[model samples]
Structures are given as C-alpha cells and as structure tokens.
Target: MAASVQIVDYVEQGQSLYIQLKVIDAETGTAVEGEVRFLGELLYGELIHEKKSPLADPVRIETIAYLKTHFGR
Candidate 1:
C-alpha cells in the first residue's frame, strides 16, 4: 500500500492535524482508482482516491492520522 500525506488543518506549530491517504498499490507500485475512496467524518475536507485498477481491496481506501503517537513519550 502507498500513502499520500497532507496537512488537513493547521493552527500554529503545536496544533496541526494531518491526513494520510491510502491510495497506492503495494505490489504493482501504482495508484488506486475510485471516486470516493477515502471517507472520513472529521467535520470537513476533500478526499480523493487514486487512479487504476484492483485485484483484491484496491478500492477500500482510507486515511491515517498522526495524533500524538506521543513523540516524546
């Protein structure tokens, strides 16, 4: 799988929210195709799936968040 990352929201240096899109192929190393791949309920945002085909779950796309995996823990 591949990841397309972007800062969804930012409010200073310490308060920023990001969104990583799962829109790439792992084996073929290509892009996934769909209209509404990433479906999130984070208030508001624009999410788009990659482009291409699939043999398995190349369609069930989603996003990732890095909310304090607690870097200094």
Candidate 2:
C-alpha cells in the first residue's frame, strides 16, 4: 500500500521550524500515530536548508518532498 502524509501543524522556534505530520496508509486512510522530529531551515517560506533525524527518516523525507513540491525550494 502507498503511504501519504498531511501537515498537522508548523511551529517556529528560534530559526527552526518544527513540523508535525500525520502519516497515513493510502489504502486504509488510517493515521500512524508516530512522533517524528526533524530540524530544518526555511527562508522566505521556502525550504533552503535541511537536517535529518534517523528515527524519522521516512517522515522527514516525505515532509521535505511535500514542502518542495507545494512550497518550492
């Protein structure tokens, strides 16, 4: 089954933006209630810098792809 993601919230603290995401199984549309954390930088509403979290790799990748596709680089 394919997976999908939704942006639940965005919070800015200092120079970092904390993204909260809801990851769902596409076929079932049921959310995976897992907490993932990522550290990244955004410039002028665009994602210009990024760092990764080992525990949240999949979610982080999805979030970055989503931001780049919808919000631009």
Candidate 3:
C-alpha cells in the first residue's frame, strides 16, 4: 500500500481556506501522486467530499495553522 495523508483545510494567517499537499514514493524515495480530500458539512447537514489532484515537483506542504488544535474548533 502507498502512503497517504488527510488534510481538512488550509487557513492562512487570517484569510480564507485553501488546500495543500505533497507526493512521495516510500519504497524508492521518489515523487508520486498527491491527493487532497476536503471534508465538511453543508447547510442541510450533508457530507461533502471535494478531491483535488495537483501535479508538480516535490515540495513540502503544510497547513498555515501552527497547531491542529487551533483549527479543531
């Protein structure tokens, strides 16, 4: 199985939310595919899944928030 990550959102210093991620192949230490799964509730209380695939060179992707707790609430 390949390695994967789940990113909820990306809130800038104090701005709107966005998505970010990186891709890597564990076995060969190479760049692989990157996926972003956005999960949230709608006004009617329905679950939503917004997936994104970004093709680019290897780079570090991280959320703007210093800690996950900061966005848990």
Candidate 4:
C-alpha cells in the first residue's frame, strides 16, 4: 500500500503561505484533505553577543543600525 499527495489549493497573505493538500490511499482508493500554513522566510537570525567578547561593541552597533533601517525605532 502507498499514498500519493496532490495540491488542492494555495494562498499567500502578508508573511504567511497557506497550502491545502489532498492525499489518496492507493490500497483502498480513499482520499483525505488537509491544510498547512508556513511562515515566510526568516528575517534577522540568532545573535551571540557575549559581554566580554572582543567584537561585542561592534556587533551591537551593527545590529542597531540594521534594526533601525529595517524595522525602524
């Protein structure tokens, strides 16, 4: 027995993507439907700024600048 998936619908809103799917069971020829949503690409990522690190100040300054440019105050 095997299963196959077919895309039933798709949608995009703001920062999210929604998908609807239909799956069929080959053995019994039964079909099921479901929906799934995924958040769009990640923006800023993880930051490791140890207080005693040599590049701490530089990293902080750069992060601030980036935030101001992208997200405003």
lDDT of 2 at 40: 49
TM-scores, one per candidate: 0.23, 0.44, 0.26, 0.43
For candidate 1, write residues 1-73 as lDDT tens digits. Answer: 3443233333322333333333454545665433221222322233331333241233224232322231211
Ranking by lDDT: 2, 4, 1, 3
Q: Global lDDT for candidate 1?
A: 0.32
The residue-by-residue lDDT of candidate 4 on 1-73, one tens digit each, is 1545556786778876565655554544566555545455432222312353222344434433443343322
CA lDDT, every model vs. true structure: 0.32, 0.48, 0.31, 0.46
- CA shift of 50, model 2, Å: 16
lDDT, residue 11, candidate 3: 41
Off by over 4 Å in 1: 1-22, 37-55, 58-73
Winner on TM-score between 1 and 3 is: 3
In model 4, the Cα lDDT at residue 8 comes to 70
What is the per-residue lDDT of model 2 for residues 7-36, given as tens digits with 9 covering 90 to 100?
778676664555555666554445654333
Query: By TM-score, is 2 or 4 better?
Result: 2
Where model 3 places Cα greater than 4 Å from the true spot, the runs are 1-18, 33-35, 41-73
In model 4, pairs of residues that clash are none
**Candidate 3 minimal-lDDT segment of 10 residues:** 41-50
- Model 2 scores a TM of 0.44
Q: Whose TM-score is greatest here?
A: 2
